[model samples]
Structures are given as C-alpha cells and as structure tokens.
Target: MITATDFITIPYTSDLTQAGIAYACRSLPYTYDRMGGSHFNRLRRIVVGVAVELAFRRRLAEEKVPHDNLGSTPFTDPDRYDIAIGGRRCDIKSFMLTRRSLIRHVSREPQALLGADALVPSDQIVSDHLNDEDLYIFAFITALTTPNQRSLDRALKADQPIYLIHPLPKEWAHPSRWIPLGTLALKCDTSHAVTLELGGQNESRAFMAEEIVLEPRKRAAAESDFYALGYLHTSNPPDGIVGVHSPSVGETHLVEPIQWGNIWIYGMQIIFTGYMTRGEFRQRGNRLPAGSRVFKYSSTRTENRSLPIAELHPLSDLFTQAKKWAKRGA
Candidate 1:
C-alpha cells in the first residue's frame, strides 16, 4: 500500500556498520534493551537515521549546498544537533513504516495536564533538544517483510537496491500534528501513552494508518508448537481477549484455552486458559486477559507437572457447544 509520494528516496552511501548501529541504539533516549523488540527493530531505526543523514550530506555536497555536519567533529558532543544548514539547526527523526503509515512515540510526558479534562497543551511537552533545533526532518523507512523483497535489510546486508526513504509533508512541522504524550484517560498507567489519529472516516482508504505489522524476527514466536488448556482465574476477562476483533480469522474466536499451565477452580468448574506468544497476543493489539495477574506460570514451562486431570475441567465442552450452534445456523 506504500506509494512513491510517501517517501523522499535517498541512495545508500554510509559506511556505518551494524555494531555502530547497535551502539547508537544503546545511546539513544529509549535504550535498545527496553524497546520490546525480540530483535533488530531498534537497530534498523538507528541505521536508517544515520543513512538519511549521510545521504543528505552527500546530496548537499554535490549540489554545493552549504551545511555543517555537526556529527563529523572529533569533539562533537553526542548531545549536539545532527546538522546545521543555512544557519538553522535540523534534527532528523526517523521512524519505520508498517501497514503504509508511521506510529511513533512522540513525547515522554502527556501532551496535556494529567488528571484534567481539558486538552490544553502542556509546557513540558517541549524537550530541550526540540527547543534548540530550528527545524525537524522526519524520515520514514520500510522494513523488509519477505525473503526476496527489496528493503532496508538489503542495505544492511550490503546488497544492491537498498530500502526506500521518505520525508513526511511539511505540515508535520506544526506542533499540533505531533503525537500527544499524555494518557488517554485519567488514572491510566503512564506507559499507556497517547498516539496521534492520522486518519478519520472520510480519509482516503490507501492513506489510513492501520495496525503495525511487526516482522517475524522482530516478534517472539509461540513457545511451543501445540496448544494447551488454561484456566481463567477471574470472572472478568480482559478487554482485548474479551471483545477485540481478530482480522486474521475474520471473526473473533471466543477466548479458548490455547495452552495450559496452572489450574484454578471457580465454583464447580475449572477455568482454563493457555499461553499465547507475544506475537499472537500483539495481533490482538497487545491486550492481555483480565485475570493475567492470577495466572503467573511462565510460557516457557510447557508441561503441567502438578495438576491432575480429575480436578481439571475440559475446554472441549464449550468448543462443542460453539460448533453445534454453527451447524444449526448452517
């Protein structure tokens, strides 16, 4: 769904190695270890950012455009701006595209005041780097999804035909378009930061910002090949496990015990649930079932060592009822 207009294509010219990329990832504000990727997502971002800067520098040199690569000096502070052109400091913000749109964490703090109903902009929303920079340049890069496809991976592997890069519209420079940093509602955890709604009902279909499709390597696969039964400890199920739509199956599958570990008895029935890989769970938009707190068994521990079958309730009974209803409708 990506189009040529969405990017500002640049040729690969940097000699930056993967080790350098990994080092930069660690140096950045959100360190690589905390970035929640099973592998490589953060590294890709760092590489792409450096590539864009290098490419921009090359283009400027060829055209005799005046600019200072602040990053070039031996004494250049890591805190200094990326580049200075025509006396204006420009900082490059790079993001990876998924489902044809970019989803980035814009602020460390909420955009508005916490615990307040009004949407007034917060003074703390501005960072020291943002305040010092005269202009912000955003670069969007595409991650390779298939084995034979052309992508940023090609550039990383030193293959021909590197990944495509694009610059967002000039309007993004405006502060209003920036993703808000604050909570969507009061009392929610700070980790639940706000995001910008890029498209609405009337927008063109091709430009909509859909759910991010994380690459296989970037996600953790299911622990075991087979599914098992688990028990739901609480009567209330989590929002994602309870009502969210699953695009893969075309219909929401009732929360079934996919993997079993610990057993809990509620009334006369044993409530069972199973382990879902972080990848599969993220497909449900990263929601966890409500009673996740009560079920603390590790996903890596596949065998149910202690529980007896006599005390465990069968999940097949619920699945059988669902199948019977489907046949009657048919």
Candidate 2:
C-alpha cells in the first residue's frame, strides 16, 4: 500500500517551462507522426511532458545527485530514458490533474494530491512503444489555475538542430521525419491523415508522413493550467524544494539543496508520486487491450499495459537508494 510519504514534490519553474517549450519547437522537426491525435495536440503534450522531465532533472541537480546529461545529438531522440540515477535509467510519466479532480480535493493549499487512479497511457505500453528503462517515474501537475500558453511561432528554425524527439537518427532503419509542425496542410482519406503541402520551405527533404496527424492550430502548448507557488534560492522556508510526506499526507520541506538554477514552477506544483522498476512493471502491469478504458473514457484508442499509481515505490526511496550508490562513486 503506497502512502503519501511515498510522493516527492519538485518545483516546476518558469525557466524550465520556457525551456520545455523551446525544446518542443526544437524537436518538432524530427518528431514522429503519432497515431490518433493532431500534430498540435502531440506538440502540446510534448511541451508539458518535456517540462515534467526537466523539472525532475532540476530537482536531482539541486539535490546534488550525480547523473548523466539528457541531451542527444540532432536526429537522435534521447528522451526515452529521461534520466540516470546511480547508473539506473529512469523514464518519466506525467499527467495534469483534471479541473474536476482539483475541485474535488485540491485547493489553494490542499494536502498532497493522491492521484491513485492515475495511469500510463495505452500507446506508451503497447508492444511496439513499450519503455525499457530501469524505472518508470510518475508525476502529477496541479490544476489549481489555468496555465498560460506558449506558442512555437519561431521556436523551430530551418537550421536549428533537433534533439530528443525520436530515439534513433535518420541513419537508423526507422526514421522520424522532420516537418514544419503547424505548417502542414493535411486531409483525411480512409482513416489516414495525408499531408498535401507545407506552409514553409523547411528544406526537410520534402518529407511528409502518411500517418494521420491533425495539424494543431498552435504548434506548442498555449499554457499548462496552474497556479503559482512561492520559490526562493536559499536554505530557508521559502527554500524552493518541498516534499509531500506519506502516512501524514502533509507537505513539508525536504532539503536546502545546493540549487543554483531559478528552478521556478512559475505558479505550479509538481509532485512525483512514485516509480516502478522495469521488472515490477512487467510483473504487475495490467494488460490494457486496444479500445479498452484507460482513464474515464469508454475506450482507449490503442492497446496498452499499465500499473496503478498507488502501487508504486516512493520517489524518496529511489533517492535513498541512489544516495547509497552516490556515496560510493557516481
């Protein structure tokens, strides 16, 4: 039984959010044309997802935990294994609390959220796209207020190098094409989204994906709905880092880390619920068939394998385990 103490809270700041938006732009060119969603929605998810991954990395840094840099060369998507802790690869899964969920339990300063029923999406767990990392870290973003939008107007440039969109480079057998995200003109035919032409002369080898990717009016997220949380860079109460302890379900400070970055969450709180090892996931993940219910939806768009958020091991526990190895070397 997972308790509140199992959850770890990390501050998501403006700098990281902007960086995530920029990253979404930088990666749009090399992004995979996914199934069942518009290219724009995919972009928006990238914006928020990247922000979550960035926030986690920042927290690890402030805590002075040694880890490998997540940056991958252009054309190679290095984000799969979001981070490495004590040599263990970690894949991050994130979700934003719905307004209803927040209204029911969250307030200006509510107890640590218990998104116990939260889950990993179907597409992520299906046979082809299943993750192979050592750990799967899940986190939740507060829906306290509406998050403002950030557009990808000039984020992607013809010459800008792309990184972290797909795991492999163009040289690999399976290639994720680079396209002007919002510029595509598409039409659906027989359940396929075919690209007619692009708005810009991106020189992306005149590449177009046959997959049905609805063009998003906005390339990136307009905003991640949320409210502000106070942040400070000191060994004080306003200490930027906070944790939601278990059993008590109380929010409190974790440590006065050696954080040098702004580590701003602008106005949102990010809490890491827990993580499951690859083996544990394989052992306990419930197989979600395609068209089966995932969240509240009557059916999911794709097949998947998922686990309950409530059954995960604590983020604090991972930190504790990392410390043991950290003391030995890296």
Candidate 3:
C-alpha cells in the first residue's frame, strides 16, 4: 500500500511542493528566496540535518538500517575533534548552496585539491576507500538555493564548483551529486562530538563552541512555539528545565524556557502575579491571592470578591486543531 508515509521518498520539483514537504518535515517557518547569505545558509544546513535525522529515526523504528544526527560538527576542519564512532573518528560537514561556489573558487589555490580531496572526499571516492564499516562520510544537504525564478536562474547558471572530484577514478563509475536522495542516504554520526573552528583572514569563530554536539539536542515539539518567550524574561532560567503548560490557542501547551519576572496568565486574564518557576515552569511558585475579577470579557464582576469562569471551549478547540496540524505536518 502506498501510504502517506511513502511520500517520504518523493523528490520535490516545485516551490510549493518543496515548501510543503519541508514544512511537513519540520514546522519551522520558511521564507522563499528571502533568507539567504551566511546565516540562512547555515540555517538551511541545520534544518536539513534535522529533517534527515528525523527520517532516519522513523526508518530505524521500522527496523531499517540505524543512524543518528551528527551534532554541531563541521566535517571539513581537521583540528576540530569529534568523538570516535565505532572506533573511527568522523566529522560532519553541512554542504549547502553557496558551499559549491566557495569550494570552486578556493580549489584553484595551490594544494587545494589535495586538501579538498583528503578532507571532503566525494561519495563515490569514499565508497571505494571505505568498506561497509570503515568510512568517514560527509552529510550533505541540497537545499534549494533560490525559490524564485530570478534566484533559481542565477544559481543554476552560476559556475560554482559542484564537482569536488574529477572524472571518477575508473574504480568507481558513479558520482554523488548534491541531490535530495543523497541527503537521505547520509546520516549524522551521533556518537561523535562536534567542533567548529573559524580562523582565516576574517579571524572569528563562526559557530559558537556551545552550539556543536553529536546528538543535536532539539527543543521538544510541545515547547517549540513557546521557547521564544524565554528571552524576554529578566533572568534566564537554567537549561534543561522542562517548561510549564500555559493557555495558548486553546488547551494548556508547553512554554519554552521561562525568564523570571513575568505575570502568569490563565487565558488572557492575569490570574496570578509571581516569578514563573525559578528555572523552569515545572518549578513550583506561590500563587497570588485571588481577587475579584478585574476586567470583563464575558462576565463582569459586581464586587471585588466574585470571580467569573473564562470561556475556554473555543480556545480549547483551537488548541486541539493546532496540535492536529502539527501531527499532520510531520
């Protein structure tokens, strides 16, 4: 049966299809052709990495070959260390659209080819040298460089060095182009630690040391929408603290990491005033003394002692639908 799950193998050809597939793969908002340059490129790599990791996770659950996310490691840097997986040290490099151009432009440098070949070996070349258990690989993600016609045309025509290798070394007949399927085939090595080093004429660290890790810890799905509020807090909470569920579109949903000094809400009405858990909402805090309803939405309070139940049915339905959409998106 060609179930919805089978759609996983489909190759996206149109902008809408691509966006739809990507959104379904992960719910992060995407702007067509707008997000570019270095930041966007890096983001694209991360998203692609996450999506690929997810797909592998699913496959493994179904008893397919095992794999995991290769957290915070850039595969190309030599001195940057990662934990040895299966007794072999493996590095992770995220290859995006501009990556080809960068390598192509730089390959003309003396001994550039040698360094490139040794550091970022081509898939076919790696296949020849690597037995089933004896290879370090690059996890490449082929994100659409440009969604619009102008950008697409520019990228396609751009003479970037897409080919890191010359004519297949006779031993291996096929070359692994940066394509969608190639992204799926490669899995991040989870047992490896990641290190990113940035030192050149620019002379600045690109990825913060804290950002790289082998497992690529993710914000839980429940907390994905609420994590943004953490920054607004006066004092940041400790990391790894589970968030509290707050009223959202409907039912209570997980809030991201909380900051101290904020009012707690029970459906738009400030029911309580206190510090949101010391580090996490899961942390307990004292609730404010109940007072007469202050403002009126559906019910008005005659005296300062009476309170009214807030309308929650409509909001609950909305929250339910939001969760459904999230599930379908995956």
For TM-score, the strongest prediction is 2
Question: What TM-score does each of the candidates earn?
Answer: 0.31, 0.56, 0.22
Which of the two, 2 or 3, has more TM-score? 2
Error of 3 at 139 (Å): 3.7
lDDT of 1 by residue, 70-171 (tens): 654221134435676544565554433332221121112111111111110122113454443254343333333312223423433653332211111122
State each model's CA lDDT, in order: 0.28, 0.47, 0.24
Question: Could you give candidate 3's per-residue lDDT for residues 69-123 as a string of tens digits?
Answer: 3353332231322322233333332223234454344223312221221112122
RMSD of model 3 against the true structure:
30.3
Give the winner by lDDT. 2
lDDT of 2 by residue, 1-330 (tens): 467766677655666556664555445545665435643445455666778888888788887767776554343253455477776677777766545655356444333444344455445554443345467787777632212211111222222221211111222212233322222222222122212111111333322222223222212111111111111112111212222111111222232222211212223667788888765677677777667754434565655567666777877777877888878983
What is the alpha-carbon lDDT of model 3 when measured against the actual structure?
Answer: 0.24
TM-score of structure candidate 2: 0.56
